[model samples]
Target: MSNVVNFLTAGVFGGTTLLALKSGVGCGLSGLRRRETLFLAFVYALTALIIGAIAGSIPVNATEQVVGLGVVMHLIIGLALVYFGIRTKKAWLSDRKDISRRTFLLMSLPCPACLAATFLSCLVFTSTTGVSGVAAGGVIGGVFFAGIAGGGAATSWITRKAGMDNPSTLGNVMLFLGLFYLLCLLLVPAYLQAQDAPAFGIATDPSGMLLALVLMTALIVFGALADRIRHTAERGGR
Candidate 1:
């Protein structure tokens, strides 16, 4: 029962609500079977959880190293994901042959935000159950697979019913959610670190502050310019 409780609380519910919404929109956007795509994602996520849990058991501060790596790459990954959203809305189908794959990757692959949640879940489960990392990982990862996949399926169904199963809608959600993630990646990590809080393993220093300020400025400029360009193009014929 403790394992079950840990699975539900730690693994199933560990991910952010925003991430759940992102997964739903991504599933809709992929035009693939949500279960199948998310299954693949679950496989990837489970593998990572197992490996991460085992690594965490080592005497060294593996959490710091692992989460540090994630923090380092999140900005780049966030930018790329936002681009994916934009391109899907504007680009031809030929350019999006791998939308399903990308969606699955978003759901599972090296996502910094999700990675943070995952390791935490693993730690909680293992600690509570006094089980080996491998045992805890399997329990947590299995429940995560079921919960996320189930939620994604339901969300896709709802969106379909609402007539939102289109690239434009998917792209819009992706764009907004991706940007939100960027903001979190940019600011939340350092703030959490400074407070000695959980969530991220980012360094709390002036460099992080400088990076955030610079990148935020760049994002604002690019967003304004792109919005202007898009609006102008829409008004091109008028």
Candidate 2:
């Protein structure tokens, strides 16, 4: 029961939770149909579960292989985020209509953050719960899906209330989140290496935690200031 609770908590507020929230906000800001938004959310959650189940099924002896793969996947994702951030900024500034809700939703489907989180969660669930195979996968996936869907819904609501439907605002949010995810991709692996800890372990490096907190705080502050400046300029122009 405690294990279940922990898995659910991680799903809601874990590092990957940010990805889910970002997807939700993107969906809302893109003016996607209500049904489309819900469909995307469901698909994302289901994908995470399926991936988690597959990861959990891997033999314990192959831990190193899994970690290596995860690292590679994250590296690719980090680079992709950097590219996407630059492109999004350009598009936003140019008032380009190149980006679409379908594209954004598709991209969010295989989020590296979600994949990593699911992988780790599956390992934890298998090890701690002594539940393996399809049944364990189903449980882990269901809980994770619930947590992500719930978080996404909550974030979508908040973003709507904050007038994040504006293209500029949405672009900034996406750029900010992209950078944040990139930072996580870089820092998390280094932290794990430094601690000589298993990727799925609960052990945390204090320095890594502090650095992440500091960086995230700075990103939030910078985003807020940028938004204020943009809004002010718009008002002045009007």
Candidate 3:
């Protein structure tokens, strides 16, 4: 049960964040003219998460070494990701070739985060269980994020290919809701397993989970209401 919880939480936190961040780019590029900031927040949240996970993984003999190394590594990795993301976007625009599903998947690979998450999670998990358990945990975290990033890239490509005429705000709203729901599902189990740990802390048990569900539900509802209001206003021309 504990293992199941851990894996699920890792997946939720890892995967949803990836999707949110990718989608957030669309929102920002859209000039926030009407884009959902929820999606953008999701992106920011996801990036911070992977950063935390990877930084947590650094093996250090001293406290200062740990802090210094984690900071430097994160900076380097963040820059590389931004560079590649830009390049990928450019490639899509320049070639005018539809981003092949395969290409998107290939591009979605989270270079440093995947490796860093695995390494860091492995170290943390290993102390709890054994080397084998840590290895498995690392694999799970890496695969989850990789799949997420890939899926987001694919979705973005498909959305671009589909091309909307008016560009509905609902698209971004749905993107945020979908990612949030998935993340919530993933974390529920993890929160359950970790509930008993003194230092570890489950982070969220039944009440917390319920609260999250309610909050996410509210977000979805609010987003939908906003969309309706916008559409009505546009039709009214004032």
Candidate 4:
């Protein structure tokens, strides 16, 4: 595929990642004024462009080295996230703080999945076409900006309309996203390696797919439960 297409695909997937989705959902619930959310969304999208440009500068041969280093860096971040998740589960379960600017920061961090998409896009672009690094980076940045910003805008609107805004929602999103990231980076990768498969393997393998399904189901359930709890509290107050 062409670099542009690769970037578009990666950008879409990157925006839909658990981290990105949480960023969107959390932003909607963050209690920021609509204008603030808009500004943050734009800034976050700009971050994608910067990251893409940096990623584009690396020679294609360092793919393996980059992947290894990425995994290590992600592991450390994943662990930190998991620790915070555990620490805050109780508050989230009970009082639930509503405002969180942290989601934006967390989402801004280059998670393993997002990095994978970036490198993969770079690889494709470099091999298939002769675009300059700057050109390729611009394309990647533009596409990613569109995906992230568009998704954020949609979520922010839906949240305002549906009244799903909650103080704790953003923190809760961070916890869930961290759990998902840890699961993918720590557990799934080891298992995939043991099975003589590639990391991030989500092909026709029923086992892999089933596990992913379970994880996704958990996220869905968590969102539903949180919303229900908020509604219940509202009714109780009434």
Of the two candidates 1 and 2, the one with more favorable TM-score, higher being better, is 1
Query: Model 2: per-residue lDDT, tens digit, 1-238?
Result: 8877677646534545455555666666556666766677677656655765686557777766666676677656655654565455556665665464533542456555456656666666566656664554566545545544565566567767886544455555555655666677656656767777764454556687678768866975786688679878988999
Q: Which pairs of residues collide in model 2?
A: none
Residue-wise lDDT of candidate 4 within 148-172, one digit each (tens)? 4555677768766877555444555
- Pairwise lDDT winner, candidates 2 and 3: 2
Model 4, clash count? 3
- Residue 110, model 4: lDDT of 50
Best by lDDT: 1
Residue pairs in steric clash, candidate 1? none
Q: Comparing candidate 1 with candidate 3, which one achieves the higher lDDT?
A: 1
Question: Over the stretch 117-181, how does candidate 3's per-residue lDDT look in tens digits?
Answer: 44444454554444454344444444444444444444445556667311232233334433444
Could you tell me the lDDT of residue 67 within candidate 3? Answer: 35
Compared with the true structure, model 3 gives a TM-score of 0.36
* TM-score ranking from best candidate downward: 1, 2, 4, 3
Better of 2 and 4 by lDDT: 2
Candidate 4 backbone collisions, by pair: 97-167, 98-167, 98-168
Pairs that collide in candidate 3 are 21-43, 57-120, 194-202
What candidate 4 gets wrong by more than 4 Å, as runs, is 1-22, 44-57, 83-99, 108-120, 190-238
lDDT (tens digit, per residue) of candidate 1 on 18-110? 344455446645566855658655764566467546745565466667667666666666776678776666543324333444544554444
Residue 83 lDDT in model 2? Answer: 53
Off by over 4 Å in 1: 1-12, 16-25, 52-57, 92-104, 107-117, 193-238
lDDT-superior candidate, 1 or 4: 1
Q: What's the lDDT for candidate 3? A: 0.45
- Candidate with better TM-score, 1 vs 4: 1
